[model samples]
Target: MFALMQSARLESLHLSVDPVTGLKAVIAIHNSQFGPALGGCRYLAYPDDESAINDAIRLAQDMSYKAVLAGLAAGGGQSVIMRAPHVESRAALFEAFGRCVEQLDGRYITAIDSGTSTADMDCIAQYTQHVTSTTAAGDPSPHAAMGVFAGIRSTASWRLGSDNLEGLRVAIQGLGKVGFALAEQLHAAGAELLVSDTDAGKVRLAMEQLGAHPIAPEALLSTPCDILAPCGLGGVLNWHSVAQLRCSAVAGCANNQLTNLQVGDQLERRGILYAPDYVINSGGLIFMALTHQGAQPEAINQQLLRISERLTGIYAHAQAEKRSPARVSDELAKKMLYGE
Candidate 1:
């Protein structure tokens, strides 16, 4: 535990177990250089406690980089709830989790992430004030999708010599809230959609409603397309998938899309333009952070659109320096956060 904390430069790690509600949670604070640590609470089934801890730590670190790159006056933290079999009483579980967040006393703020929802945030809000994405704030998935759409346009402009998505083939690997919303945006822009998801119902819905061609989940990565958008989970772009990717660019809403730095290098070698995940996928975080500061809705909407500008700068720098966009983004974020 100490090794992981030290390696990730984590400032704090808190573990909470509610025997009555059967909630086991880990909260990791990666940095507080800019301000209070801010991130979301992720609820998911994990293989083991060690895996959960590793995920919390790694995600917290990414949040730190994400905040710095987006110029948010906050640090990075994450909360992970381990979903166990026969878990009973979600309200009790989240209330207990909210208490854990309350104990942090605003040092870390919690929002919604995958496997969690706005309703869950509303439940959590019943216990603590540090939570966002409540019933009033609504879901941030659409805003996140907007950012990804803007990123796709910028990337398309650089890679395909046009910013238009009309008739451009885009294979989206998830049809969840953000992915489905993104599909709506792309479809309205006249992009050809190939979608996949574990849920057959979602895949079928995409096919029927949006005219998206449904691909089996297993075949999403290798399907020939102009862009491969993995909006589901992280670690999907490892060496094996990178070698098999048949796309000009990869950009989506998933966090930690690359397994490691070397995988990003491999994508560069393969001539795939990877819009660094943290840089392009920061829209939701930006929305949450700005809303937390009581920024007006119009201001938040305008700020979210700047994601394309930020990505364009990163792409330009990558081209000028002859480096991968991932490397350039990492270096720029580190310079902003640590001046090194």
Candidate 2:
């Protein structure tokens, strides 16, 4: 009951076009204790309207907590689009989507997310002025990659008791912009990599760039490795998928990775380390605030480092109380912002 009430503070938007393509659109808006609601617009080909709506609700809620945890001024929000290929390229729907954002009048600022690109945001920017970028001058992806990499290192240190990533076999699902960028960082840190994606081109590029071994999408799930990173969509780590996993730690940039809220306890029972998704993937949001305010990296780095500290504390609290990391994360975030 305590957990359920904390989850209801998020607001959501739902849009869909039926019979034509069965595509749906959803947006979530999480307001700030500090300022207005802000985040990126994500476009994806979801299975249905309900899925999009669920994604929007969960993402917006995650953003709200993420902002609080990361010590940012803005709150949480995300937009989702379910589309049929060629009918709506990101170029078309994203800008039209920006029209939706314009109506919000800075109440919610949209940037980039999964299935959305800077190129997509560039188009969206034409429609609305309340937009943030990872690349206005210094793109946030690389910096975000750096922060997540730092987080991974921190996780390794906590879990493995060693800072060295050498010879660590990490399996990454969905090598998109952020994942690919992260792969390079891990490579530099001496981690052996296994990567998978639906796009053959991205797989090939990852193999060439990071020297990662490629696994097909189906095969990617059960790959025997140290870390299981999901950088794609949400709700991948459920009762079903958790039964299929063959890794030690779960980490990556996917939001709402848990299908049910209790799955983190299930992972812990299975002897798997679960790095809460909102905590690890928060670099994007932190970077958004940093760039939006035109601050230097030095100052922003301090904020992102706080994410690591927050994770460390959550892990400790979860470990001590035998609680799920996600729940612990929520409590800690609420504690920081609202004095809970």
Candidate 3:
């Protein structure tokens, strides 16, 4: 655990275990230089404690980058609740997890992430004031999708010589709330859509509702398209997958899409303009952080547009320096977080 913290440059790691509720949670705080650390709570089944710890650490790091780039007064942190086979009461488990967050005294603020929902955050809110994404805060998926949509326009302008997504073939993987919402915006913009999801129901709905062409999950990456949006899990673009990509660019709402930093170099070598995940998918973070801080609705929307502005700058810097945008983004985020 100490080694992991040291390697990741984490500020601290807090653990909570409730024997009765079977709540084994890890909250990794990556940095608090900007303000109180804020990130989403992920409740998913992990193969082991190590995987859970790694996920918390990696996501917390990215949250730091996301918050800094979005100019939010928050640092980076993440909480992961390892899901067991069954729990007698879901609310009870989350309430216990909320209490665990309360114990931190506001050092880490939790919201909804993968495998968690607004209802789950409502349960967490019942026990602590350090939680967001309640019913009142609203779902952040659409806001995140909107940010990605704007970033895609900027990407198209840089890579395809046009900011118009109209008639562009966009291949989207995953059909979760963010993915489907992004598809909706893309379809409305007159972009041809090729969508894939593990849930056949979501794929069918996209086909019927959005006129999206359904592709097999295994075939989405290699299928030729203008842009590939990965709205699913991270590590989806590794060495092998990058080698098989047939798109001009990659921009999505997934966190940590690259398996490692080296994959950024691979994308650069392949002439694929890779928008750094944290830079492009920061809208959800912007909404969750600002909403929790009581920012007005218009302020949040204005902040969302900064996603495109930041990406545009990053892309320009990458082109001028002959470097990957991912690397440039990391450097900028590090300078903000560490004064490096």
- The TM-score between candidate 3 and the true structure equals 0.99
* Residue 57 lDDT in candidate 2: 71
> Can you write out model 1's per-residue Cα lDDT over 195-252, one digit (the tens) per residue?
9999999999999999999998888899999999999989999989898899999989
- Candidate 3, position 51, lDDT: 98
The top-ranked prediction according to TM-score is: 3
> For model 2, how does the per-residue alpha-carbon lDDT over 233-277 read when each residue is reduced to its tens digit?
777888878988988788887778898767887898898888888
* Candidate 2 global lDDT: 0.77
Model 3, range 182-288, lDDT digits (tens) per residue? Answer: 99999999999999999999999999999999999999999999999999999999999999999999999999899988999999999999999999999999999
Worst 10 residues of 1 by lDDT: 134-143
Per-candidate local distance difference test? 0.91, 0.77, 0.94
* Residue 316 in model 2: lDDT: 90
- Candidate 2 steric clashes: 3
Candidates sorted by TM-score, descending order? Answer: 3, 1, 2
Question: Which stretches in model 3 have alpha-carbon errors above 4 Å?
Answer: none
Q: What is the TM-score of each candidate against the true structure?
A: 0.98, 0.89, 0.99
The local lDDT score (0 to 100) that residue 94 gets in candidate 2 is 65
